[model samples]
Structures are given as C-alpha cells and as structure tokens.
Target chain A: MARSRNHEQWTSPPPFTQEEYVDSRIYSDQDIFEEELEKIFKKSWIPVCHESELPEPYDFRTTTIAKEPIILTRAKDGKVRAFLNVCPHRGNMLERAPSGSFLDGSPSGNPRHITCMFHAWQFDMKGRCVYISRQEEGYQDRLKKSQMGLRELKCEVYFGGFVWVTLNDQIDMTVEEWSAGSLEVLKPSLDEEPLEVFHYHKAIIPCNYKLWHDTNCEFYHDYLHYHNRITGFNDAYFARKNTGFDNGHINVGSFEVQYDNYEGSHSREEISFPHLPPNHWYMIDMFPGVNFNLRGSSLRCDIMTPLGPNEVMIEFRGLGLKNDDAVTRRSRIDHHNSIWGPFGRNLHEDLLAVTGQGSAMNPRAENRQILHGRHENETIHDENGMRHFYEEWGRWMDRMPSNPDKPFVERTTATSATG
Target chain B: MSNADAVRDSIYRSCMYKDDMKWQEWLDLCDEDFQYSITAYSPEIRNDMIYLSGDREEMRGMMKMLPKHNTDHSPLKRHCSVYAVDLEDDGSMATAVSSVVVYQTQLDGINSHVDAGESKVFLVGRYFDKFRISDGVAKFVEREVKLDTRKLDKGSHYPI
Candidate 1:
C-alpha cells in the first residue's frame, strides 16, 4: 500500500533488451512452478543438511526437496543416505520430527526393508519393501512388499561439509562440478580445516522464495543498510562483476561486501577468499537456491526455501574453525551472531525490505517494475545477474532462450496503486 | 523454608525470568542497584560474552522501546525448571541452579512455534538485606543469564 518506488517499465517498449528480463508471468504462474520443480530443483544438487547435523551413525534429519519431504540419515556403515520421507503405502510421512536419533527403525525403519505406518507395511532403506504385517488376512495373495521401501534419492556430500540431494536419476555432475566457480571461494576456509557450524537461525518471511534469492543475488541494495553505509563508505563493497558459464544453469556474481570496520561499523573492503587466485571481495549466488559469501574471518551460507507463493523460510549457518580453541570458538560465535542472527542489524533490515516488497506483489497492486542500471557488462554496477537468473529460469521453464530473433513470454499484471 | 532458602527463592523468581521480558516483576525481585546480563559460553573461544547487559532502569527503557523499533520477527516465551538448590554456609545468598527452554511463536504474519534451547543458571545461594533479603525473601544485586542457543531463532524487538 505504500507508494511504489519510482522506476521504469523493464519489459516494455521504451526498448529494454531481452538480456534484461524474460517476463513477470513467471512470478505468478503455478504451471511454471511445477516446471521449475522438475527441471531445476529435481535436477540440481540442492543442499539438504550439514554434516555436523548427522555426525554419529543413525543420526538423522528430515527436510524437503521441492515439495517432497526427504530423510537424510547416517547409516550404520557411516555413509550418509537420503530418501523420500514418505511412507510407501498410504503416503504417511516416515519421519515427523525435524532432527533426531533414528530409534523406531534403521534410518528408513524396516528391518531389511522400509515400512508404512498406515498398514505396517515394511521396506528396507534401499526402497524395497521387505515385509507386511497381517499378510494373510489383509491380502491372501495380493500385495507386493518387495517393491515398496522409502524411495532412495540421489545424494552426495561436498568436501566442505554440505550434503546435497536430488530427484534426478542420472545427473553426472558432482557437487563440485555443479558449484563450479563457487568452490574457489569456499576452498580457503574449507581447505585450511574442516568447517563446523556453530549456529543455526531460521526466519519466516512473507514473500515468494525468488524475492529472497534475488535480494541475495543482487548487490545494489547494500546502500539500504543505513549502518553499513556509514561503516562501509570507504570499502565500496557493493562493486560487483557478473560472469555466465557455458552450462547456463550455473552463474557467479562476485562482489565486495564490507566487514565491520574499526569504527564499529562496516565498510566494503576488497577482501578475497584464500582460494580464489583473484584477490577481489566476492560472493557466488548458486542457482536453484543457495548462496556462498565470505566476509573477513567468517563464511556464511544462506539456504532459502519457498513455503508457498507468499511465504519463505531462510536458514543461515555460520561456519568456523574446526579445531578452534575454547576462547576463539566463543568469539567466533559472538561475531557470527552479531551481524548474522535474527537481531543482526543489517540482515534483519534487508529481510524487512523484501517482505515489504512481497506485500505489494501479493495483491497484484503494481505493474511492471524496472531493472536498468549503468554498468550492465561491468560487474560493479551491472543489473546482469538478474538477467542471468531469468535466462536460467526461462530455460528451466521451457521458454525460448533469449536469442536475437526470438520473442520471450509477455505477461503484464493489471496495475493498481493500493494506497 | 530457612531464611537462606527463602532468599534464594525470591532471587530465582526475579532474575531467572529477566531474559524472558518480565521486566518490572524481574526488577522488583532485585535490589535498587541491580546488575543484569544475558551472557553465553562460547566453546570455540571458551569465554563468557555479554550479548545483552543491563540494569533495572536500562531494562525498563529497553523493554519499553525495543518493540517500537524492531520490525522483524515473531513473539516468544521462556519456561524454566529448577534442578539444583545450593545454600551457602553463612546463608547470605543461596545459589539455585535450573534449566530453561524458550519457545518462540511467530505471530505477526505467520503462526508457528520453535524452541530456542535449554539453559543453565545459578541463583545467589542465601539472605542479604544489602544485596536484597528480608527474613524469608532474597533479592539480586546482580544476575547473569547464560544461554546455550546463541542465535535467537526469531530475534524479537524485545528481550529473550
């Protein structure tokens, strides 16, 4: 209802190039969301859980991949496995709790098979139903137990302590291969020593998940943090570079972000991760929902998920020294929590901005918003990252790729000033 | 209960809930010059750091103004169960220990609940008129809140 920020029509005929955006319809259409579920989330190796969360054998956690609930557990042999959290029969959720020790059964719960709570149908962790209770009375010769266990999902763990799961049956790309340039930014901290997650915080924001992803991907908005502005004035951290790869699914946007300065405020400084040969401050907004950022002594990973069109849940994890002394560990936690936690002055402000933007989008109260900036090719001021996201989104949504002669989808919601 | 025991009870009642935002009631259980802090033990650093440090008046000002400024997050409540009670020899201050669990409820736009964590505390272990004691009552001149869960799940505009 607040007055819409002044801007140009990005998708219209004053002649914005196809390189800028595909269309706004992608934001509202449910069919598009389904297509994305298949082409993107189903195929990409999405982060499921951190290794620290399941260190001991049988330690398990349940999370959702796209709309499907997934179970990630450390099997007795020490390998971590992921499977559909759904019970094979009647579709009851196998693991109701978020994080816990797997006690009722093996991570999947069927002795040599997985089981369904509804009918007591059991199956092994390998997705093969091994047994069924009341076999004679329920179905004299009718049901098949051999074919029913919790569905096994394609899963892999990266060197940096993150476990990823996917729905696709044959994705040849390894986690490192998928992450590409991102590994360069992560290797410094991850290489020196294994990283351990010291803190986990979740915030539920009222907005579509893309809004959060876009906010994370783009850097021009750093000027909105009133405190960061004063502290980061000298650093000029918002300066960014956008790079696109041949695979098209993965892209990297490197930008400088300020670390809290001597004045107790932050100024963007060009600080590079130890691994990247280029010593420029940077971040890589990984596609399909993950961001890796490095600032000073710490590293942060933002994992975002869509609860619905109007709700998003973001989880932030701060990584630190694996063998830090007691005193150093405490300091790391404090430093991490100060600017990253729920009360973090800067992030909390950014979240509010996105949620507020969501408020307007939810009601279809605004028409086409613009995305024009001076530095398109030059990373520092370019709006190209967004263009890249839309490019990839279009590919996954089955839309025509942005060729010089092709026309992209055109969707314009009726505009209104809610105020 | 002995005089020392009574004093310990009053201190626990007042100070234990300070992080929970029961400001006035918490202050009333403290002496006029009380020092209250919300600190955490960092295993990496192996030290105690103050996330929030305040006194009665400071808390009063914070409790009153925080909600007005905080634009993000849901509401929360903390429930604590006492586990240990230790009485000093002179009975000047009784040190009581207990575990606490904070449940956060998202209220502004979403309806949800999350538990922050279980914390441990030590209440002054006797009686002290100077520190806050009246026959069967005990008040705190100082109180400390240590939390295991450092990152507040939904950092409220208000205290714990």
Candidate 2:
C-alpha cells in the first residue's frame, strides 16, 4: 500500500503529519451529526437575542435552537424568561410570529396575556395559564389549567446585553464556566458604555451547521477574502494572538485594520464601541454555534442553528452604542454593512467556501482529508482554533471528529436532552 | 435632450451599467457625494433595518477589492421600471422611485449546469433615489432601496 500523503502541505512552511490532518468522516457521516444535535446543540447554552430586543415588560422574541422552537420574553416583574414555543394543550404553537408584545396595542384596553390562537387558551407574561376555555364544565375535577404554564427553560440575560438559554438544565456548569472565563473578559467591554443591536437578518445556507461555523474558526480562509487581504493581513495581522479555553471557546485577537488601505474605502473616524478604539476588533467563538464580535465601529453577534444534515440557519445582528448621533449611527451602520451585513463583501465568500466544502465532502464523494495543524504561535493563519474546537467536539460526542463513530445515548435520556 | 429626459436616461443606465458589470462607467454616473443604502423593515422587531449602506468612496473601495474576492459566479440581471420622477422646485435636485426585480443566472463554476443557468427572481424592491442636477446633467446623490423580500437565499455581496 502506498504511504498516505494526506497531511503534507505541499507549499506551506509547516508540515502536517497524518495525525495533523482531520479525518473526513465527520463532514460526511450521518451518525455523528445526530450525536452533535444531542451532545452539543441541546446541551449548549445558546444566546437567543440581545436583551434590548424586548425592552418593555411582556415583549418577546421567538427563535429556534437545535430544531426546537423557543420564545424569549420579558415578564411584568422585570425578568426575562424562555420557554418552548409549544402550548401544552394539543402542542399548538403559542406565538407564530417572530416577535410581539403581549400587551394589547389597540385602544380596546384588553389586558396583557400570552394567548394561543387555537383553542383560546390564555397565558400571562410569566407563562402562567390563567384562563382555559370551558374549564368549569369539562373535566373540572381532574384537569387543572392553573397547574400548567408554558414549559420553562433555564434562561439568563448576560452582561445586561444578550439572552441565553439551555435546553439541558442539569448540565451543571454555569454560563461563565461553559465560556471558560471569556464571558467575564468580554462583558466589561460590552456593558461599559452599552451597545444596542441596530441591525438584524438571518440567512439559511446549504451547508452543515459545523461547516458554517468552520468559516469563522478557520483563519487560513483569509486568502479568500480580498477586502480583508487588502485592508488587513499586514504586520499586525501576522502579529495577532489567539487564546483557547476549555470547552471549545476561542478568542482571536485583533490586528489593526486599515479600511482606507483599499481604494474607495473610507475611514471609521467616528463612533467606535465602548471599549474598542477605531478600526480594532474583538471576536469570541463559543463552541457549537454563537459568535460575539466587534470590528471597527460596529459590534456583531451571530447564532447558527442546524436545520438539517445539509442546512443551517444563521442570524446576524449589528450593534451600536446607545447614544450615537445621526452621523455616528450612520457611520456605524455603514461600517457594519461594509463587512458584516447580509449583503456584506465578506459573508458571501465565506458561505461559498462552506457550501463548496460541504458539496465536496458529501458521502457520495470520496472521503477527504482536512488539515488543521498550522501552529504559527496561534496567529491568524494557524489552524489551532479549529483543532481546539474539534478536540472539544470530540470530548462531548465521545468520538474523535476525524475518526468519526456513532455515539448512542438512551432515547429516554435524549427526551430530557431536548427539554 | 430635455433635462427630464436626460435625468431619466441616467437612472436607466445606472441599472444597466450595474447589471453589465461596467463598474467604472457606473461610478462616473454618480455624483461625488453619492450615498447608497438598502433598507428594510422587520415587523418582527417593529424596527426599520439597514442591510447595507455606503457613500461614493466606500462604494469605490468595495469595487476595487471585489475582483480579488471569491464571489458567486451567478450574474444578477435587474429588471427595473421607473415608477415616478419628481424634480425639485429649485431644479437643483430630483427624486425618482423605480420598481425593481433582480434575477440570478448561474453562469460559472462546476455547478453552473445548463439547468442551473435558468434565471430566478432573487429579490423584489423599489428603488428610492435622489439626484443632483447641475449643468443640465443628473447624477445620483443618494439611493435608498426599500426591499420587500427579507428571506434572501444566499449572501448578497453586491448592492441591490
């Protein structure tokens, strides 16, 4: 048999041994994907939205996590709560729209309640089922509508900015621990002067959820981003630092970006975020699916959820300071749009890479080899971020991502996994 | 040509120039102070949103770096019809609204099969524009795209 030459970098400085290259099976196999939905997606604490989304009591934003629909709402008591969007009776969706206020907007003066369109079952902002149709006449003795409220999940608003929830409540570790101390480091920057999300959009891509995430973690893909190359990738880019904590969380340091280096590029002279200076960046990739980031004058957060084996939904939010003037807000908006907007110059190229890699790594195609062995002291070009992430991924699924295998947990256990 | 007709032609040529990838020609048509943005409203959050925004210099920078980026080979063809044109009383400025629908045709790459080459409606929107008319020529000062379609299939690197 010929020697396996999968890991060698034919042109680059560092050489990758066979162990250095990631195995192709993780990208192709169905068994490993299912395990991820349980071990990673369900168990992870995913950020749902910025708390500013529902500033008033009884306001709510609805979203999905790991294919499970969820609703995040503010209570009358000044607390944010999360629940499965499913109503207990007949499992109908409580709120069908993406977001809304429980308080009646009309002059009809109807009291605030979370009412299900079907069956006329009414719930309060705290998810208490206050009214049930025909409760007195039918099964009054046995059925207790008061006993049932919308199913609640463990939800917390972090650093007074983001709302995060976990489907598995017994995961033991707190949000701070799961993030491995990075959350604290980031909170000060996020909260100091306060930032509000000014832009929001979601795109469903034809790629695996992990593939969509790889675009963020893999640094060598910089070659694919011309704008980044032209205005970025200078001495500062090469001098960047990366830190990886436990549980697959990675924070890559910033290189001073010169947006003016490219022709027609304008300077971000006004409106930088709370802690950052002009043209600087801060990024944190939490394992599984959330990325909180700052670049130049705009702050952004992206959350990815798996739609299927071959599909992923990504939500992007652009943020600015709370007190920006019209010009500063416009400058922030312009800065945000230039790079992170749905029509951004960077994202399309990243999506193409993810989808293209997905297409090539499909089961029918020959199983391939992917390398994440670069070690330039964990700089922008290093593959250690991806490697660190996959290693943590392996620990959770109990299967090395490179040499993939099915991880079978009891089906009863999985029921709670979706809680 | 009448000033109104000249103004109308400039707007028509802007869309055509963009569709044809005649970048420099399109840049020449815009005023020095051009500002372009794509804006939308989300009933979900009850807020108006900005998907993209830039001025002339920023637009120029994006175009300059566009060539080096790995972009989709799906050439977008825009179908636009001028809906209304209102020149200001001072005649120094004008505003126009146009209905626009862009179709994407997969023209390049391994996936660019003949079947995939069939164009499809990518987005539907109205273009809200402002122009500065000087020396009997109209150049774009601002273009705000009010989009109706929020569920776009892929990343839209190019302006609508």
Off by over 4 Å in 2: A1-19, A105-110, A267-270, A406-419, B1-8, B87-93, B113-115, B132-138
Chain A TM-score by candidate, in order: 0.81, 0.90
Tell me the deviation in Å of residue A13 in model 2. Answer: 20
Q: Write one digit per residue (lDDT tens) for candidate 2, span A126-228.
A: 7888878788887677889778798899988775478889999788887777788766556766878766778888887767787777678766788888778
**TM-score of candidate 1 chain B vs. the reference:** 0.68
lDDT of 1 by residue, B24-128 (tens): 786777777877655564442233445555566766654554443435444445465556555566766565555656554444422223222322221211211
Give lDDT tens digits, candidate 1, residues A192-217: 65677766656777676777787776
| Interface RMSD score of each model | 6.5, 2.2
**Could you give the TM-score of chain B for each candidate, in order?**
0.68, 0.93
Residue B138 shift from truth in candidate 2, angstroms:
4.7
- Taking the tens digit of each residue's C-alpha lDDT, what string does model 2 give over B14-87? 88999988777887899998998899997655689888877787777677767777888788888999888898
- Poorest 10 consecutive residues of model 1 chain A by lDDT? A410-419
